[model samples]
Target: MCGSDLHYYRAENDGTPAESRCIGGHEPAGVVESLGPGVNGARLSVGQRVMVHHYSGCGTCMNCRSGWTQMCTSAPAKVYGKNAHGAHAQYMAVPAACVLPLPDELSFCAGAAIGCGTGTGWGALERLGEVGGLDLVVFGQGPVGLSTTMLATARGARVIAVDPSASRLEQASKFGAADTVNPDSVDPVEAIRELTAGAGAAAAVETSGATVAATAALDALANWGRLCAVGLGGTIAFDVRTFLSRQVTAMTSWSMSSVQQMACADFVARRNLPVDDLFSHHWSLDEAVPAYEEFDKQSAGKAAFVF
Candidate 1:
């Protein structure tokens, strides 16, 4: 499960009755059990493996036609597992446009990762531009941050991962981070500067959603550096003159579009990257209560409920 799932679980969600509460599981990958009428069988079949794009919008919108249904402007958008029925169940129903073909080389769990967290990482890095042969720092060692670390390193970036948890930092190293930093033990900005020969990283991606960590990520960037913020929540102080003088570019990235999701899946499949390794726990539905209880602690990697 993802961090957002926990957020939905704990939230009162508009004071909706418990019986009408939304289900929680947006990153969904599974075989197609059936398809609705008017869906092209050539594009999707009864048993074809696929992943859901998760967000649906008004079909006539330009964004929807362009495959970015999440940015639909014509009407209210629906997010699976949030406002609508999600994939925490044995089966899920979604519009045909919301489905993307998954590479046969990857497992359903890996496809699920690509559906959200890993896809989020890919989107953030894309926003940061080229990172080859440059130093990049990723704040927060959660699933999304770890994915960014791995994907950036794969693209020839020397990644410096920052987190307060030693265990997460260790995981970052295993994921190909050249260096790791613990803000709890050291000034992260200073440490990052030292690691980069006092020049600071060329780019920074913040996934922790912590205001302090976001600020540190900004401070840890070199002049003319690019900063991509992926973590949600919390307002970060943005100094206009400071950033203007530094010539830093700061951009926020949401999750990937359907096209990007396919690209990310293809990248993972071609690299044969161990995307499954991101999951530390593979649980069954019967164990969901304890699964979330442990995941709520916020120290582990991704978790999945296997069918």
Candidate 2:
């Protein structure tokens, strides 16, 4: 399941209303049980196992037509496992446009992560800029942050990963982080600046979703540096003068378009990266109770639930 499920659970866990309940998995994959009417034949067919982009929108809208169906304005967007039933069930009905063909080399779990978790990081970096030979700071060594670290490093960037969790920091190092910082032990901005010989990181990406981390990421940028923000939600307030003076570019990205998702999977396969390194635990649908308890601890990476 995507981490978005945990977010919706926490944000709306308050006495929202009876109608607020919705199916919760977003990153999902399985065979194409059947296709909807007028579904295109280019990317999908019956019995093909595929991962989905999760958002279904009116096909006529500009956003939908432009491959950004998630931002469609035609109607209230229905997200798989959110307002719409997602892939957690034995079968699912997804738009053909939302589907990405999965190669036999990739497992269902890897496909699921590509649909969201890794896709999110990939999209963020795609928009961030060329990272080759650059010093990059990735705040929050969660799943998305780890993906950013791994991908950025694979692109030849020297990665400096920052997080409070020692365990996660260790994982970041294993994932190609050139250096790691425990925010609890030192100011990440200062440490990152020091790591870059006081020029600050050549680029930065903050996936912590914490305002404090976001602010520090902006402050840790080199002159003319770019920062990609993919964390869920947080008010980011930084000194405008400093940002303007440094010519820092900050952009927000969610996940990859269905098209970009295939590119990510290709990168994983071609580069032979260990996408499964993000998984810390696995379970089955029958083991839901304990799975929930383990995930709530937030001390591990993404967990998988086999059907």
Candidate 3:
């Protein structure tokens, strides 16, 4: 997906050779040069452009049977560029079962952007439960946060976006956020409270890795509010009493199911939801070094590597 933190899967410092020396790319897309035999249950064809959903699970697992291959129980989950060879190559040979036909309207760049981060953001909203006519706040204006904000707004919710970067907040505004907050200056929780007329938001999504953002995300919600945390690193702490009092339903949304992932990409294309707006940077596979360098520094919005 077109996410900054998603490069963590490609980080060399992780002490795993799967990253340092592997052909690294999970948010993969391109034409299907070929498909392995035994690929069943999907309608992909040769030479068709496609977005590769990142999930290589044992077919026997219930998780895989349900299309949540990320939760494969028969074996440790094996995904491109993570535990196996990846898609950042001239040619890839993934099971046809794991590929989705990218709409002709979607760019390969846009297709790849839906790889993980965008789908992760979409997954969070799918878990948010009936957001229509609700007050929605997203903590962070990065790819995942922006996706949540955009999709929630598309679902008829009023979206408030929060981030430390003013520039990102500006992008959020263009992505359909009703308002933006910079927590670096004022407390996001307080700002959300003020914006929501002190009742807090009806729901919130925390995509910032900072622990404070997690707590702030929860703190900014009204009673019985739903929240989904998608950030990779952090520790959230709050009094049990406050949590109990609010009756909050907290969920940590990870990678989405295949159905959810396909629906998200389709939703983007069908709605013409300027998902490309989330991407401020693009590069070719040959320029991957500088691309990751800039994105690793968190310099801009969503980034994707073009073949």
Candidate 4:
């Protein structure tokens, strides 16, 4: 499951109501059972393995046409597992446009990740331009941050992972982080600076949504460094003069577009990267309550409900 799933589970989302009872799982990967009317048979067939895009919107809007259906201008977007039926059940019905071909090399679990968590990492890295050979700091060792760490290492980046949790930091090392820092023990910005030999990081990605971590990520960047903020929630403040003088470019990335999701799956497949390693738990549907209860502690890696 995604960090967003935890937010919704905890009723922490402002966009969702307290009394709302929608199915909760947007990271969906499954076989095609059947097709809705007007869906070309050639476009999707029974038993085809696929991942759903999760967001449905008015078909004609510019955003929808561009494959960012979540940002459709014509109408409110329906996010699977949020405001609409999702993948918690044995069967799920999604619009044909929401379906993308899963790579033959990836398991359905990896396909599920491409639907949200891992795909978000790809989108954030895309915002960072060329990451190869950069000294990059990734704040937060959650699933999204760990995905960024793994993906950046594949791109030849030297990654410095920051997190308060020791277990999560250990996972970062397994994912190829060159160095790990526990912010609870040391000042993250200072640690990042030391790791980079006082130069600070050439780039940073903040995935904790913690104000302290976000500010530290910003402060831990070298001049002209790029920072991609991917975590949701929390407010951050920085001095304009410092930001201007550093020449650092800061940008925020939402989950990802459908095209990016497809590309992410292809990239993972071709690289043979262990995207499946991101999941620490494979839960059956019956174990969902305890699964989520364990996940809510924020100590484990990604968890998935396997059919």
Name the best candidate (by lDDT). 1
Reference-based lDDT, residue 307, model 4:
84
lDDT of 1 by residue, 1-307 (tens): 8998887777643465787677789999999999888999889999999999999999788898877899999988899999899998899999998999999999999999999999999999988888999999999989999999999999889999999899889989999999999999999999999999999999999998989988998899999999899998845688797788888888899898888999999999999887898999999988978988898897778999899
Clashing residue pairs, candidate 3?
1-116
Which model, 3 or 4, shows the larger lDDT? Answer: 4
Whose lDDT is higher: candidate 2's or candidate 4's? 4
- lDDT string, candidate 3, 195-283, tens digits: 98999999988898789889888888899998888887877777888789789888888769888888888988999988777777878
Question: What ranking emerges by lDDT with the best candidate at the front?
Answer: 1, 4, 2, 3
Residue-wise lDDT of candidate 2 within 1-307, one digit each (tens)? 6677776666555665758666567888777888788887666788887878888889888888876778889798888877887766666776677788887788888888988888898998889878899999999989999998998999899999999999999999999999999989998888998899999998888898999999999888899988888997776777687577778888898787767788898888888888888998988877766876678778788987777
- Which ranges of candidate 2 are over 4 A from the true structure? 11-13, 36-43
Candidate 4 C-alpha error for residue 155, in Å = 1.6
> Deviation in angstroms for 21 in model 2?
1.6
Better structure of 1 and 2 per TM-score = 1
TM-score of 2: 0.94
> In candidate 2, where is summed lDDT lowest over 10 consecutive residues?
7-16
User: Can you give the TM-score per candidate against the true fold?
Assistant: 0.96, 0.94, 0.93, 0.95
What do the candidate models score in CA lDDT, each in turn? 0.91, 0.84, 0.81, 0.90
Instruction: Please give the RMSD to the true structure for each candidate, in Å.
Output: 1.5, 1.8, 2.2, 2.1
Question: Which candidate, 2 or 3, would have the higher TM-score against the true structure?
Answer: 2
lDDT of 1: 0.91
Which candidate order results from sorting by TM-score in descending order?
1, 4, 2, 3
As a whole number from 0 to 100, the lDDT of residue 43 in candidate 2 is: 62
Estimate, for each residue in 73-102, the C-alpha lDDT of model 4 and write its tens digit.
Answer: 999999999899888888898889999999
